[model samples]
Target chain A: MDVRSRNHVTVTGRVGGPVVMLAHGFGCDQNMWRLVVPALERDFTVVLFDHVGSGNSELSAWSPERYSSMDGYAEDVLELCRELALGPVTFVGHSVSAMMGVLAAAREPEAFAGLVLLAPSACFIDDPDTGYRGGFSAADIDELLESLDANYLGWSGAMAPVIMGNPERPELGEELTNSFCRTDPGIARVFARVTFLSDNRRDLSQVRVPTLVAQCSSDAIAPPEVGEFIHAQIPGSRLTTLNATGHCPQLAAPEETAAAIAAFARAAG
Target chain B: MTCGTGGEEGGRERDNGSGPGEEEALFSALLEDSTEDLYEHAPCGFLSTLLDGRIAKANATLLDWLGYRRSDLVGRRHFSDLLTVGGRLYYETHFGPLLRMQGEVSGVALELKAADGSRLPVMVTSKVKTGIDGQPLLIRTTVFEARDRRAYETELLRARREADQERDRLKLLNATLQTTLLPPALANVPGLDVSAYYHIASADEVGGDFYDLFPLATGTWGLFLGDVCGKGATAAAVTSLARYTLRAAAVYDPDPAAVLANLNTVLNHEYNGDDPRFCTVVFGLLTPDADRGGFHIVLASGGHPPALMMRADGTADFLPTPGGQLIGVLPDAHIATATVHLAPGDTLLLYTDGLTEARTAAGGEDRYGDDALLAFIRDLAPSTASDTIGAVRVLLGTFGTGVDDDTAVLAVHVPRAGSEERH
Candidate 1:
């Protein structure tokens, strides 16, 4: 099968404009960028795709050995870029996808023009000796994994609203919950493990592309410290803190997220 | 009473005194009594937390379950303090953020650390209470005891783990049994180089492919490669019977065709009725020719793929042995024979159909047919026995999961003198 179709790539906006690829985080599909895509589509070509085993992407394309690490996911992104003939494109990644962007850009610097990382965290588990707080400890991650395994439906119902962080619009939370439930549970468990257990602190230094670290003000997933750390590690990278609260700035505060990405893209150009 | 309209009037007055007014008084009293009492002694625990997850209010039922007094929790500790270490971590990372974002979270499983150092399993549901201005004010949480549910979940997990272990054990047993069916190593012929390989597609089930190269007597060797009709225990039975019978038969009569004829008769007699088992096999008897400095090989085929012979002069082709019927199928079966002299630097290759029948492409529509094998052999002509088998192994690895059937290959070659030393 063609790599573009396998990843379910969808293109929109100016036909020959600078490409802007948007990648969603874990537990979400490309639809998560519905709010943010409209703002970027007018000036730049917007490329959106679901990760394999999520959304409309072919589940058969998901091999355990192939996608066992973040590197494998990065390979998929590079493959998509190569197949689409996208040259030095702006890559916008949210949450776990932020690390995916980093890994891809580091491997093939010529494939990326710039990177916009939304609420990115290089590591999740807290290291006492190193004093790096990714928020949860190892045991807490285990409990979360166990909870997911025990009743993924219940976990999705409980977590989706919290992750979306727009309590005023209960419908938004409901939609996110439905999306979470729609994901295959077996794939979700493996994805969850890969997301939480990954430590890409060493990989941050290798990013050669001009990057923007857009941190949410009160994100429980990736705190301000993590964003600062990423900004410091990447050479010639900018950091912008959005007033938006929660882990998902694109969902809760799309305008600010898009404005930051646009500003970074313009500055890079 | 006497001044009224006697007995009828008196009875109506008595009913009016107790009917509506008395019932209203009693219902009001019950409502007033239960309101505060119900909140304190409700079936589930109730608590309210500030935006920062600090305990602002807690009910008596929750306090009782954790062996904590109201004074100890309220204004003194955060809601996360009551949770176990792991639960606390989960609460801080997942639950806290979710409640803030979604405004509500339900049926979250957690364990609370009791005052006496015991753990209490609970299911928590929390909702954000918004003010009139649409701002989240505080979190209202309800905790339900989940002891029974937790126990059931634990038992289920244990059963699943046990089943996985049992499957692993069965796989180990099958692997050990499979190893016993094949020869440990091919017997080293005096003047020829020999090599063999067996590829197993799956470890869970035992495949019926078998091969053996053993010395029959002084200066003669009996070799065979075959695949049984099915897999698992049934095919394993046929494979064992065929291997032993071929060796015993070849010892009695050294001719390749006569040896296969004996095997056919034995299998047809043993499994002649319903549930008859069968196999496709190639049997070879080798004798050294002193004058040519090579071996004379006579091969008999029973519905097997034709053997490929790569000659010393950079040429490779199949030695045809046609019209052979599958062993153990009928009362009498045809066993085709072919005689070939393995001159110096010539290799004879015998393999089952698994290699040819493997899917060659991702779509799985095309098989690695006989023509592809023939082309491959022609390219690899003048190859040593070890080199040919090594190349086939590498080629099979490229097939990945597409090679669904077990494959066995046996090769014997007469090495060119003084070019390479024999091991």
Candidate 2:
């Protein structure tokens, strides 16, 4: 199988420079990075690819047994890196892909130079015994899943605005909603379960790369405490709280998000 | 009252409200009394919160449901504080942001924590009140009791989960029943190495493919492999009947061709109608030849794939039994017979069409046909029975989801003279 066709990889920007790979999260595809790409493209090589069940990637490549967990997604990331011969590239992951980067970087530290996690959560369900807050309970996750299964269109309409978080710019929310609606409903249901039910807390401590956690202010999806938890677990990691509000800072506040990432990438390099 | 005597004067008096002053006083008093009563004791709970989610004002009906005083909520607690932990999380993540972005959200299911620590299921609808400049000022919310809806949804979820469990149980039952149709274990043939494997394409549905290797009489063994016309209970019935009949008939005659003839007669007699059933089977009778120090095997094929033989000296070929008709298809199905000797270190393999007809490539347009199997066996000449079966198992795994049919393989090898103990 062609790895490029498998991931629908798109590479642009300065040649022979440092490569910055952008991986989108669960609901949207690589197009979610549209606003943030131009900022880094001036100096760095920007690479973007959708996960297999999202965007223009081949739908036939989806196998339930292969993609039952995040490990399979991590394999795709590593495969993409190896195909491009990108050595020690910088990885920028949004939402669930943030954890994918963590898993990849932990397993193969030599493949990544630095990590930028945007609105990432190592776990989504709250663990009462540990007093750790993941912003959702198991029942809430169940309700969310049921809502997705019952009326996917209504769920998309109700959830896209909440995830995008900018009332002033309704177009952003509209775009996010459209992206959610465009996805295959069955794949989206499975992907949603995989995303929210996953627990990568133990993988956080294994991240050896220079990591930057960029959390937005008042983000309901990933609370401030979750960001602090990630920063604490990852040794020598920097935590920067952006002035932006909501779960998606890349779409909500691109300039600040890009500036923060660029500053970290330059320093890490 | 006195003006009623005149027609135009009485009409003017009534129109100007001079005739019924007492009745007008009662209607105005009723309207003034009900306005406040409506807000306080409405059917739904009503609340207004500050921009930061703190409670600004709550209606009397909401306070009564939660068993809280107006002072306890207003100016003291946030609206999120009244929700259960999970509901609070959902409110913060999905509800609050949606209200901010869309200005309103409706029919969101949530649970509110009451004063006594019990949970109240409610459906909430909230709207962000905006200022003159289009900036959000506060949030106005309506809460409806959803006890009936919650109970119904819970029942629905429970029923769905039970149905899933029941389906899994049925699959297990079918699998167990399918296993019973085959031999528990191939009879231990002294001085010979034997192996068999069954590849099931689906766990939910039972396939009609079956195989067995069992002893018949002194110094002779009966081995047969077949695939019934269809799957599920109907084909399974035919498969069981054919397997038992073949075993029982071999005991009476011991000739491979005669045993298959008996099965054809029984099937043709039992089913000769619109819903007729049939199968392709190959039966083999093996006997030790003391003079040659090898085994003499006679195979009878009834529209089955030819058996492959791998010689000890790195040579492989198929023992063809052509011109045979499918068993049970006719009154007297033609059974073709072929005889071969399994010398020292030689192996013979019998398999159903599942192997040759499997989709070999990723596109699934091509099959792993007879020629491909011949070539594959040629590469593995001089192989033992277990080794041949293991190699085929690995190849089948590579085919992944393309192999949409059940496969049964049986191989028997006569070990070299000195290696009988190892075999």
Candidate 3:
């Protein structure tokens, strides 16, 4: 199997530079890193890819047995890294992908130089017994699933709007609107369950490499304490809060996000 | 009141300098009321929110529909507050990011939570209202009620699930029906080795291939393998009739040629119509040769592929049963017979054309033909009947999806004095 075609892997940035691979979370594809890729291109060899069954990745490759849990996604990440063969790369994972990176690095620590986890939560559902708050209730996650059903027919209509008048990059408007975050609903359901319900808190201590836990200052999804919790769990990990709002710091504050990734890759390499 | 009438008659028509008639005066009053009335009583609800999603204004229609007062919503509620918990998460993760990037979004369906805790299904369209400096200021949203549309979608989803269930049930039914057309197990013929295998090409559609082995009257056995024309329900019906008729006919006559002739007569009479069904079959009658220490077998064919023999001396060839006509194709179909002595360490195999016609990886144009099967068995000569059947099964597996039709094979071998037990 051609792993590149299966995952829709794309490689860009300075050739022969230290590798930095970016993995998108749920809902969106590789385009989630469009804002951050430019700043990192000067210093690192960047890699971007969509998870299977999302964006332009091969839908036929996705099976419920393999992708129902976190292991399936983590396997794809390791396979992608193996396929690239760009020795000892730094992985920059966002949202749910942070957990995937954790799983991948834990399984094969030698494959990675360092890890940058952005706006991540090890588990999304709150556990009352342990007093660990993962930001959402189990019932709240179900509601989110219901919301996905509501938009089943409305997805195309939502994508139909023309993205006009973004002053930063007018030429990119055509490509941006249709391609961003358009996921197959069936795959999206499995991914949503995997992203929100999976508990990777126990997997954190297994990391044997340098790790950076980057948090957004005002993210509704992963609050500041979640970042602190992750940092405390990992051995000798550093936590830094970005001056950005929302769950997506890469898009909200790209320059700062990219700079953090580049600085880490250089120092870790 | 003819308001367009001649000049001085305007007073009776109640025309003034400002207006022509009472209807015109009423229209003028309505025109003056429209500005505020249009905003408050529009068919769809409207809301204007700050860039941060705080509601700056809520139309009276929106407030009334949601069972909320103007003071209760405006300046206090965010646009997401009107949504259900699920809708709010969806709005934040997908809809909010889209609206922020796209500048405008439309026809997004979401369920709103009313003050009374009931659900209100709605479709919303929102556009960013940018200031003159080209920075986003606030959002202008229009909400359309979609109660009927949601009900319709729910019904559609339910219907799709039923169809999927029905399809799965049909496949299970097909498989059960297929098993009934063949013998549960081959009858154990003492002092002789017998083996059979049937490969079903599809689970959904029942294939038209069958084989059976059973005991006849006294110290004799009957066996046959055949392929009925076409596939699915109609072909399956024909296969069931052919298998039962061959068994009953063999019990009556025990002669290989006579048994097949009886089957042809039964089928030709039963299906004489335009959609007449037919099959190619090979039937065999085996009797133990007391002195020669092997069985004497007579094989008959009805437009079927000839049987093959793998000999004790490491050689293989097909037994020619020429001039046989397809059963049920004519009033009097000719049955051709070939006699062979099943010597020790010699195996005779009967099969349908599905075996030879199987496509091979050599390309679409190539088939694993009669010559290839002859050569393959020649390589495995001096083999037992059970071993030959096992080898054929492995060969068929190599074809994978190339074998589109069902295949049936039955092999009979006479073991040498000290040969290994039949597999």
TM-score of 3: 0.76
Off by over 4 Å in 3: A1-6, A56-63, A153-187, B1-42, B46-61, B68-78, B92-107, B125-142, B180-202, B213-223, B268-277, B285-298, B305-323, B329-331, B338-423
Weakest ten-residue segment in model 1 chain A by summed lDDT: A151-160
Which tens-of-lDDT digit does each residue in A192-211 have in candidate 2? 77788899999999999999
- Residue B82 in model 2: shift from native, Å? 14
The local lDDT score (0 to 100) that residue A179 gets in candidate 3 is: 64
lDDT of 3 by residue, A1-269 (tens): 79999999999999999999999877777877887899888888999998998878888999999999999999999999899999998999998999899999999999999999999999988889998998889898898887787777667656665546655765566566556545778778888898889999999999988999999877778878899999999998999999876677786677899888888999997
Q: Which is better, 2 or 3, measured by DockQ? A: 3
Looking at model 3, residue B240 earns an lDDT score of 96
TM-scores, each model vs. reference: 0.63, 0.65, 0.76
Clashes (candidate 3): 0
- Chain A TM-scores, per candidate, are 0.89, 0.89, 0.95
CA error at residue B22 for candidate 3, angstroms:
14
What tens-digit string does per-residue lDDT give for candidate 3 at B1-423? 544433466454554453545656656766786777899989899999986678999898888889999999899988888988668767767777677667888888888888999989998999999889987888999999999998997777678668868988989998899989988889998878889888888877999999888999889999899999999999999999999999999888889889889999999889988888899999988889998878899989999999999898988989999999899898899999989899888999888887899998634767899999999988999788888999999999999877888999999988888767644
- Residues B172-246 of candidate 2 have per-residue lDDT tens digits of 988997899889999998878999999988887788898888898888998999999888889889999999998
Displacement of the residue B106 alpha carbon in candidate 1, Å: 8.6
For candidate 2 chain A, the 10 contiguous residues with the lowest summed lDDT are: A147-156
Worst 10 residues of 3 chain A by lDDT: A173-182
